[model samples]
Structure formats: C-alpha cells, structure tokens
Target: MDFELPEEYAAITDTVRRIVEAEIKPVIGAYETSGEFPYPVIRKMGDAGLFGATFPESLGGTDAGFFAITAISEEFSRLTPEFGYAMNQQAMTCPFTIFNWGSDAQIERFVPDLIAGRAIGMFALTEPGGGSDAAGAMKTTARRHGDIYRLNGSKQWITFANACDTGLLFAKTDPAAGHAGITAFVVEPKRGRGYRAHPIAMSGLSNCLRSCAVFLEDFEVPVENRLGAEGEGFKIAMNALEYGRLTVAARLTGLAQACLEHSVTYSKERLIRGKPLGEYQMIQQLIADMAVNIPAARALTWRAAWTMETGRPSSRAAAQAKYFAGNAARHAAQAMADIYAGYALADEYPVKKIAAYVNMLTVGEGTPNVQRILLAEDALGIKDTDRHPVRNRARGHLSR
Candidate 1:
C-alpha cells in the first residue's frame, strides 16, 4: 500500500502543525500545571475545523479522510499529547459514533454543534461494576415507559463527563438478551433533560480531566433519542471503538516522536565525560531504536486508517497497531527518562510529561495484553475463554 500522503493531506497536516506550534504548545504546560482542561484552546481547534476532519462537508467538516485525521493527531500530539486527547475525544470517539448511529434528527441537532465546536461530546460505556465484560456486567438498565426510556445505571471513567454537552450512553434494555440486550442513547445534561454528571478526581491522569463516574437515576430520554434501534448499541460501540483504536495508535506515535526528538536533542547538546552523549554507542543505540520504532508505528497506524477508508475490517489491524504503538511509546518515554536522568522527573523537562502521556496511552484505547489476546483470536481463530471477548480493556468498559 502507498504510504506517501497526498498533497492535499499534507496541506491539512501542515495546517495542523502550524496551529499546534502557534497555539497549543506554548500553553500546554500551564494548563497541565493548573489542572485545567484547555477549553479555550479546544474552541480554537473547533474554529480551525479540526473536530470534523473525517465527516462530510454537509456536516460542517472539511470532507477529509481518516489519513488527514491521523496526521493532525500525530502532529498535535508531538507538540502536546493532552491536546491530542481532546482532539480524539472530539474527532473520533464522540462525533464519529453520533454520525453513524444517531437518528437523522439527532445528527441534525448535534453534528453541527460538534463540528462548530460550540459544544463538546463524550462517549459513556464503561461502568463501575463492569470492566471488559460490559455485556455481562452491565447493570445500567433502560426501562421502557410510556413514551420515554428511564435510564438507571452509573457509567464510570467517562472522559470529559463534566465538560461534555452530549454523550453516547449505553444501557441494558433486555436483561435476558445478554449482549443483544444493550441499547445506546444520546444523553444530554441540560436544564430540561433528565441527566446528571459528577466529576471524579484522579491523580494519575492530571493532564486532562479524568473520566467521571456518572450516575443516571431515573434519567429520562425521549424515545427519539435512541441511537439506531434497541439491541444495536453493542455493534455501534464496537464499530466506533474499532476506529477509535486507530486514533489511539496515531496519538501514541506522536508521543513517541516527541520523546525521541527530546532525547536526541538532549544527547547531542549535553556533554558527558568530555564527549557529547550522542557520541556514546549506548545512547546512539537508544536513539536508533527510537527512530526505528516511531516510523514503524506510524506505518501501522496509517495502514489501520487505510483499512477503515477502504471498507475493510480493521479490528485486528487496529488491535495490533494500538498494542505495538503503545509499547513503542512507553519504551521511548523510559529511554528518554533514563537519558535525561533527574531532569526526567521534573515537569519542566517535557520527558516527564511524555512519560505520563505514554502511561495513559498504553492503557487508554486498549491495553497491551488485551491487544495480544485479540491478535491471538484473529490469527489462531481460537475463541477466548470468555465468548464475549473484547479487544482493549481500556475501552472495553472495565479492567479485564
């Protein structure tokens, strides 16, 4: 497959690069230090039309493909991985699912706001009691009553839960149908709506807002708010996640790139024993390995994006890409930290921030062990011990 980006895609990527350089990188550390979510910067991203790259122009997007989206993700992440998180939450997880499964009316009502960045969206699938076994452990129920669905259940680890305008909420509609019983709804936390969201504090992922545990008790959703139809939520969730996994891969690739660049610059400039660190064979090896892995991860990410664009099943490729890219990022971060020594532990060094970002990415879209299991099933055709196996534990709604 041709890996070279077309001129048009390059232009879009270049625009994203310029935006990151001019806007995001300068203030990322301040935002992280203050424990803020960078709302104004995200609004600027909306003005730049970064939120709708993959959607059609009819939906206020640029009519871009997933490749362009990948490029945007990589560049933004290279500068500030937290911004990458926000971008993915917007470009991939939130709006993509809505456009695909939402009713036409729902699309009309939400898509424009999303593309315009007037409102942010989030996906709510994971729960407190259920981890990866969401289908079996789903305690959230949507009871059919009169003309509305009464949603009762709590979703845990919901990203942007406190800041999002709409969420793709999953609930079990038919308790007896197992996975087939699940249904998805468009839940809006507004004055007239029946929804409430509370923030969950977290120390591990302080760069962005940690996912929240939202309790939906007697949450009333209009019958029209149901996405697609009943019993179709699982498929919708999976499809959205399949694409979402690729974004995670792309974002990790960017973070790895940052680590490598920072490490290389430090090695070249810092003198060790009357010689620059770059002259040492061991440091050279680390840098070489990083160079080798970054592009390799990038290729895998591009292939996964291409798979989606070409109407192919990307589940296996997505799993592989996310797994490999995450490992590569972690190693890069560790290697950079070692090279930087004490400086790596401080936030001023960017390597420490890179380390945290890598830690989050390794488990964000999917965990490495979970991806291996997915690859095993895809390659060997061996069914997992759990028949309802999920690809990534991070996105699968709980820890496996």
Candidate 2:
C-alpha cells in the first residue's frame, strides 16, 4: 500500500519527463494531423534504451522493474498520449511479450532487432468479427502441414502494424480444440509466405496507424515459430495482455493528469463573471474532483504493477486499475471541455486533442467494460480465472 515511488524510480521518471518535453510536446499536433507513425521519434527512444527498460540486461536493457516502467509511462503520457504509447509498445509491451514467450531462437533473432528500433513488433488479438469476444470471434486459423503451418485469417485493429516488422499473431491451430485450439506465433509479414498487411484508415488516434487488419492466406510459418505450446496460445496471449493492460492503465493516468492540469491552469487564468473561473464554485468543484481522481488512478496502477512485480497474480487489480483509470481519463477530458467551453472544441486547444487521445486509450488494449467483467469474475471466484476465454464455444471446436 506504499504510495511513494522509490528514489531510483523517481529519478527515472525525471529522466523520462525531460525526454518527453524535449522530443514529443513540440510537434504532437502535427503528428496527430499527419496520422503518420513516428519512426524518428521511435529511433530516439531506441537509442536511449527506453524500449527495453525493464528487460534483462543480458538481452540489451537496463533491467528496471515493472513499476519503474509504469512510472516512465505516466510521465511520458502526460505530454503526448501517442508518444507514450508508441514508446511503451516498443520498449515494454512488444518486447516483454516476445521475451517472455518467444523461443530462445525467436528471442535471439527478434528481441535485439526490435529493441534497436531497426525493426518493430506488434501484438494482434482484436478482429473485425469479435472485438470484445476475441477468442470466439477470432476467425483466423493456422493449420499444420508437415513442417510448416499455413495460416489463413485476418486481424483488425493491429497496433504498429504499419511499421512493425514482426508480430505475435494469435490463430486457431486446432479448430477442434476451440479456445484450446488457439496458438500464438512469431509471425513476420515479409517472411510471410502469403500474408498481406493493409493499412486501416482511422481518425482520432491519428498518431497511430489505425490498427491494421493483417490478412494471412496460406502464409507458411516454420514450426519453430510457434509460441509456447499448442493449446497455450490463449494463455500466453492473456498473460501478455495482463502486462499490457497495466501499461495502458499507466498511460490513461497520465492523460487524465494532463486533462486535469490543463483545466486547472485554464481555470486559474481565464476570467468569468468578473473573476477567474477557478473562483467560480462550480468550476472549482470540477477541478477539485479531477484533482482527486488522478492520484487515485496512479495509486491503483502502481498497486497492480507492484503486485505483478511481487510474483502475485493480479488480474483483478489490473482490471480495476485499467477500468478506473480509463474512465477517469475520459471523464477528465469531458470536464476539460466543460471548463474551456467552445475553446475545448477547437483543435488548436490541447483539450480537444486530449479528448481524442483519452477516448482511444479507453477502448484500446482492452475496453473498460470488459475490465469490469474481469474484476467481477475475479472477485466472485468464477469457475475460470482466465476471463478472456471464449465463453460460448465448446472446448473442442472453434465454432460457437
């Protein structure tokens, strides 16, 4: 229950703050408008080893803890949500997942390349057919054919798809095994045999190349690329998400903090009814509530990170942290809009951009509502600890 970040972690946060202020704040709007992936920015992060902060030094990292990683996320996100997310995906999410699940050969081949920012990696689980019900709605299949597995399916909303050279792809390997049939693979599009990745057009989170829908049609993959074991894809994917959810929670906290700060600052300077808006009772109330929420969100996120670092299973805590922080960010954005009135709607005003960033973060990674279900399941001690498994499908078949 300690709320204090360690001195070393605090130092890390300070370092991250300087990096974000210098590199991201100046051109955030332009990046958002262009909707281009920030490759140069990513290269800077890679050079700083920001992408591999928590990874083992043996694999080219500083070997910081998960909490330290979240601490950095919070600081960076406050400046620019896209910048924070892109860096995390590069530094922590994609690399950590691969390092944790990828084979030694896969690790040797991919981790260094990814960390160097020479290549990029993405994790895809969302699909067009099923957004929340990822497992049952996953229509992608990877069938075994001797030494090679031929994959045929499509994944939508795949983050970093445009720039990522490699992906941790989830597909059904044993249609007969249902969720158990799901398998994780270290899939590269160029080595793709028959895969096609097309850019998906989306607005709002324009800094991100809207999650691309990757199509695999008889894409041949070596058996060695199979992550973990057959029937283990679902588990590996869930574990990766458990870690990723915390990172998202941290980012949401940062975005919410930014919204609150913006609103507070504007309220202090803008006069209304012959006095500063901060002098108005209603405006003060909004600002006060916002102030209260940011720390609560940070505390929850850090708790979850601490739990994970301590080797405890923390799905409930993770879900609660993500759900609360995401909602907080969205509410803070709206509050900022209310405080600024017409100005909040203007693209030039930061709150307008803040609203878009918060909205996307709320739904991405995992939606807030799904997190609620996860929290309930964990609290009630549901039959399955794993909440993401396809509920309607039988164990043996992919079909519902």
**Predicted structure with the largest lDDT when compared to the true one:** 1
Per-residue lDDT of model 1, residues 141-176, tens digit only: 999998889988788878887777777888999989
lDDT of 2 by residue, 1-400 (tens): 4368889888987877776777766766577678677777677667776667666777777767678778878887887676776654576557777777666788788888777677777888888997788888888898898988898888887878767787788999887777898999887777656776677765555654456878778988889888878878888777777778888899999999898888888998998778999898988888888888888999999998876676556566777888999988988988899999989877778877677778877887678778877777767887344444321110111211
Question: Which predicted model would earn the best TM-score?
Answer: 2
lDDT of 2 at 389: 34
Steric clash count of candidate 2? 2
Model 2 local distance difference test score: 0.77
Which regions of candidate 1 are displaced past 4 Å?
1-4, 25-37, 192-194, 204-209, 383-400
Alpha-carbon local distance difference test for all models: 0.78, 0.77
